[model samples]
Target: MSINFHEVKKKREEFWNSSLVYKAIHDRLVKQGYHLIGTIGAVKRCHWTKEAVVRKRFCYKCLWYGIESHRCIQMTPVAAWCWNRCLHCWRIQPEDVGMHWDDTRPPVIDDPEVLVEESIRVHREIMAGYKGNPSADQLMVEEALKPKHAAISLTGEPLLYPRLSELIEEYHKRGLTTFLVTHGTRPDVLKSLVKEPSQLYISIESWDKESYEYFNRPLVPRAWELFQETLELIPSFKSPTVFRFTIVKGYNDNEKALESFSRFVEKAQPTYIEVKAYMFLGGSRGRLEHSNMPSHDDIRNVGRILSEKTGYKLLSESIPSRIVLLSRIDKPIRHGKGCPDGVEHPEKYAPAFSKEYEELTD
Candidate 1:
């Protein structure tokens, strides 16, 4: 439980500036294994990052792209702010704990360089537990200590961080690839980024305005329009773009939804499309039913339909994650230092400790 308290005064200032909301949110997030860095940034060890070293199992990112799961840091610059309270998102939302604040921005903006450096420090501290595990490979654990990829989609709309472009640049300067995921609520932030991530992911959960409001529960006005603006902006990015669909069974997986999704794909023209099943974990368990979780076959079926609709061929499937990859090109674009040789592919194994390690940090 070694957390990065970069400046206690800054932490106090953040709490004072935002009333008690910040403290309440901070304690809860800390209990969830998120090490708060500076006033706003945080780093939480990914489940796959641990399993990669201890069990030789990697996440779908490793199979799809070449990210070595063990050598990746799952983090966020603004952990408590987001526009959308999507029903399927696994992270806890403000309202879930009977707390609400301005989700539009953070109470305090931390330095991006300090965020990157301290996040990596916390990442290594979190990995220390895995090093002593009997099943851990010492060599892999050593590599895990030196993270090479930053998954900046941990628990918030990272675009709200204000200095996100600088954060991405800091990570890149340290030789780490970044995968930034956003809810498409901030087209302005996307456009403003001078340093783009290695891969950009937009979480597109619904097809139309009605469904968007229904599932996303976005706080801002005209959220659908903002989303459309982001879709249009995706094609302008020089780096690879991804449209990620977290399919909730009997919700967005219907025929009509598929048609609308195809239309969105046409607009964005992202390098890849990921159709993944909505995971019934974390705060989502309180919002959605376990029955909403789709089967791997369900995901594959949807992938087939989208492939036909968008002409993005079904390139691969990671059955354990219930995710199918649709690509306009022949193969996935690898990023960062890839998984080492002879690593076990996730497709052959069951989902990586979904329940057993759901509570682990770092």
Candidate 2:
């Protein structure tokens, strides 16, 4: 079905204002200034916790959060509309929840400078009441209020935004690092990005083109070709690249599929590989059975199989969410100079080419 970006945008606005989940999340993000958006149910199910929130506790299990103890500030840039309605996605839907392109994206302010100013202003207003909340940790609260990094992945394909490259450069000039997560549907947009992000992530949900189409429900006609092309070009860029595979039980979790996935990773040679289990949420309930969410052991087994095939070591695992990290043993850690943890600052980290772009643009 061809998506009308304008209608998608309108529906998203209506949904964002009316949906309890969206309001709950928006309220928290506005108050805290930043928050991680991912599968809360997966986190809870893995951790065996009654709490439904996906927060620092769950983040502590993640490779990036585990490695960087002092780092603060994380948020997916936009809250609505994604280009692909992946069957594995946990977000609830009638399949067009927010998938619009027209004027649906937040309007491009007349002045970039004004947009920055308004962003800061809105951020402060959202955080106003939290100033005196007794339960709030002052240090973490302060960090959350600051705009250190913007992750361009929340619910949608950020590259679809016509002004994405411009927005990335603007963030870079503000000394904020940008993290872009793409579904690998648009290589042209990826290629055109002016500022290299601290990290560029491509999600490869399935190894085979047919399985990819079956799983991702991408809007583009030739998504598989685009995914392959993007993987091939990842090595040429200096910024850290991550290949994310959200493992679904009956779909691509078997040995043959995993082996094919490993070969793709070997060819791409990204700095990191994340293997995560699919969580049952949102619109996925209609299309997938609850049994599709794999167990922690299942996730670990898959990781082991892929690791052996790719010669990548299993570096970390978020036991609660059944997620694992794999990396080449020989991959060198290029610690950014400003990062105190010896790991790149979550916000300052960018692809190696970002500096060149920054210099050229200046």
What 10-residue stretch in candidate 2 is worst by lDDT?
41-50
Give the Cα lDDT of each candidate.
Answer: 0.82, 0.56
TM-score for each prediction? 0.91, 0.69
Query: What is the number of backbone collisions in each predicted candidate, taken in the order shown?
Result: 1, 13
Candidate 1 lDDT, tens digit per residue, 87-143? 887566777678877867677788788788888888888887776788999898899
Give me candidate 1's TM-score against the actual structure.
Answer: 0.91
lDDT of 2 by residue, 1-362 (tens): 24343553455455446656555544433342232222110000112111111122323212352222112233333444455668876433344333323322333222333333334434444444355666544554454455454455645566656566676677678776666788877788778776677778888778788887788776656778888888888887778888888888988888778888888888889888889878775457778887888876888898899888888877666554456778774433432222232122322322122211121121
Give me the runs in candidate 2 sitting further than 4 Å from their true place: 1-80, 90-129, 329-362
